[model samples]
Target: MGDAVGRRPAFLLSVVVIAVFGLLSAVANNYGTLLAIRVVVGMGIGGLTIPFDTMAEYLPQTQRGTALLSLSYFWTFGILLVVLSAYVAQQNFRLLLVLCAIPCILSTLVAAWFVPESPRWLLAKGRSAQALDTLRRAAHVNGHPDAVSLFPLGMKLKAEEPEVKSFAVICSPQWGKLFFFLSIVWAGFGLLYYATIMLVTDIFAQDPAERGEADGEGVDIDYEAITMSVVSEFVGLTVVMFTIDRFGRVASQVFTYFSGGICVLLLCLFASADSTSRNLLVVLAFGSRLFMSTGSCVTWTHTAEVLTTEIRTTGHSFVNSMARVTGVISPFIVQGGLPYRTIGVILFIASILTTIASFCLPETRGIALGTAMSQDSTTAKERTGTPNSQEMSQSPATVSDKEVV
Candidate 1:
């Protein structure tokens, strides 16, 4: 929908769907009705990627990595809030659902009123007049009214050829190899991420006798441990935010996946040891959560940057859907009566594979967004340079007039 109609419309539609279905879910009186409503809510949630695509297109290359990575902080904070809500609502699921719906409702208003369509998307569709108008409006709002002069009044982008379906283009030779490696990276991240959570939860939920603890003593410890793990996510985001643009996306992901896998293996070993101290187990679990959180943030940033703008959202959504599939498969492995060590071994191997896949992806650290599918054949080295250097090297007034049109 974003690729066809426009990003703002698709984003607005998504938030509206979530807000409406989320409220309905709170009032659902039957199990089947709630399940149906929640499924619709999931559909809405899937379209949230449109906003990320919009953000990437609007920002300049220099600030793009930091800006995108900063968005992950909201995810960490949202999780913390959900943890609090779960604690407060306890058995009042309806209240919890209402709390969850509030953010979507707020986001809907913001999207409808504040968000504008991407000028790049407008230009890609050969809507040059509208794209110029959008840019002018943005410059006026940013207190740079004269900046609009950088583009000529009669400037026009060459009309793109009759549109091809994004799926067909992504599956073609140009994008296929990049897409395949990205799918593996995303899927491995998803599986390992959820598997870590399940493993930690399982350990805390063990019977008191099995845990070598007094019957009533585990509850407080469980809450404290969970809180620490959640806090570790913030630490992880901080680490990645500082390193993503500096170290580049590929390096960041490679380090996080490999180190995170080791943490997972150590966590499993300590968890299964009867003589291991609880403090040691908690520390290892925190380390695992921290590394996984870092990997997740970098993966999202890298994928958004690497794909060309022509099929950016479609390609991103496809790879993310692969992640969702692995996310679904994670629970069965964690809870399907596999030995703890065995589950850990499987996740470690998956992470190692993902790390290898990360190495195969092109570095997109400082390149301008590729505006055409044909640009995919260019080597990463050829594309890599100071951020926005090609355009910024030109005088502002002549930049878009010469290159963009």
Candidate 2:
């Protein structure tokens, strides 16, 4: 929707929908009603890709990874906030939902007043005048008066306006390999990362008799483990902020996932031992979590980088939707009645899959975000030694102004 219309409109719509659904959830009288409303809220959340792609288009390419990874800070903070809110609003869950809408409302107001549509989108649509206006405003705000030089007027662009709505574009030979590979990586990582979190909680759970005693003694959530989990995620993000550009996206992913897999496997071995120590398990869980979080950061940042601007939002939406679906299934896979040792094997396999997928993907550390799909395909083929597809003949050699936006 953002690709067809504009980023600002889609973003505002998402925010409004989320706020409405959130409020509706607060008033929901039944569990079914709440569950249904939450699904709607998830749809609203799908609009997140619009702003993420827009930010990528607007930011300097060199700093894009750093800026995008920094966005994770807000997500981790939100998780911590939710945990604290659960503690505070134990029996007042409805009130908690209502309070959550406040930030959404405020975000809508701020974005409406401040956020601008993507200039790249405007230019692709042939609204050069509007694109120029947006660029000028950005220049003035950034205090870069010479930013106009970056976009020279009347320069002919060879980019073909992509068919953003057609799923066929992604399925075609030119893009299919990359798209399929990324889909696996996204699903596998989401499954492993979420399953591990759930598995750790289950691992630390007390037996039925112990649970009854703990309840009588007022012991509830595992504060130590939860705190470590949240803190390790932040630590991983911080590490990525410094290492992503230095190591490149592909190398970072390969190393993180491979290392994380080993850590999880070791943790499983320790768990399988006759003498299970809580401290040893916690240490191993923390190590696995740190690398998993690091790998997750790389996955998101690199996905945005490698995709072309025309289909960037659509691609992000698809991959994110896949991740969410896998996340929903992860808990069942890990905590399901399967053998306990099987958990480590599952995650270890997922990590190896991610590592292989990372190798298949091209490096995009210093690549220009504004490059077109056609240009990127050529570069990717050269880097990977893959054959160029004849599908290039299908795209127009010269796109006239009247033929595109």
Candidate 3:
């Protein structure tokens, strides 16, 4: 994600195309057409998620999660804002797609102007002097002073020459364990997020005969539910940012999945309830998104944080891409069922996968960005028993989601 090659115009153009896919989705005439559009949207999103995670890895550890969390907020805001914009444009249906393209075009312009080159990339290429300058620039972006301590100081480097690690290099035995953890975590992330959003529309669009009228009772229901769902994601990201370091990565992620599971399961009960219960279901669905994303952001940050610099971007790109495979199928799996309980069951499956994966992980609350953990090395043990201290001083503080936001 932080690689210099990723900053080239070609990759940026690909991201723009992804936005175009989402922009055209409303005009899709059939299920097949819409499904194809969504796949395009997912691919674009997959592209975006990687670069952003790489950005976090390139920044200082103290600011890494917060920086990434803020990006998620902007991503949330974009989703929420776009839905609202699309609804307005729907008044003149043909123009809505054009309006959708406006934001993407504008973002492309802005990114070209200000998205800084990755400092970590420069370091990997043996451009140490330039990398140091890039670090100062990043500190300025993060609202820190450009003084001596602006960039982290204790990081040790072993690479003597610039060598680009191939994607296949990612699967070597040393990096494979982290790679597996990221894959499972990202799959669980993709399923929970996409299924819930996809089901929002399906649940509201009951049989045509049973659909609520736009009057007091309305079939504008899908719009209503999806809008709230987007808003809830912003709120979710906010909660994760404040408490992410406090709760520790493992605790935050586990809470998101286990608690999100309980919240989504409430939908099953609500599925059987009266109209008032149905109304409550909307809020519950929104809350479920909140928690799921909360964990997703943390999980992504952890994945980027724990891997050694040699394989960091490879690990990130791999997980983000694999996550899309689950995302492409999740919508159909949930929507194909008659009862919405089917969706609840699928989410429960994702939650369980995430929960089990969380246990296989270690807490990375204060770990520095770009440093790798050695779980099997006894002499390198850090803060194993000190749960209450700021961080164990025995060893120097060591290094170590999500919508693309």
Which candidate number would show the highest lDDT if scored against the true structure? 1
Per-residue lDDT over 195-276 for candidate 1, one digit per residue giving the tens place of the 0 to 100 score:
8878877776655565566654433327577778888898988878876766677778888899989999988877777888
Better of 1 and 3 by TM-score: 1
- Model 1 misplaced regions, further than 4 Å: 145-147, 150-152, 155-164, 206-221, 371-405
Which pairs of residues collide in model 2? 125-405, 126-405
lDDT of 2: 0.74
Candidate 3 lDDT score at position 126: 72
Task: Compose the digit string of candidate 3's lDDT tens values, residues 183-275.
Answer: 788888888877776666556555534644434432344678777877888888887888776666766777788888878777655764556
| TM-scores, all models, native as reference | 0.86, 0.84, 0.80
List residue ranges in candidate 3 displaced over 4 A.
1-11, 19-42, 91-94, 136-164, 206-208, 211-219, 272-276, 375-405
CA lDDT, every model vs. true structure: 0.77, 0.74, 0.65
Selected candidate, larger TM-score, 1 vs 2: 1
Q: What's the residue-level lDDT of 31 in candidate 2?
A: 95
Pick the winner on TM-score between candidates 2 and 3.
2
Error of 3 at 398 (Å): 15
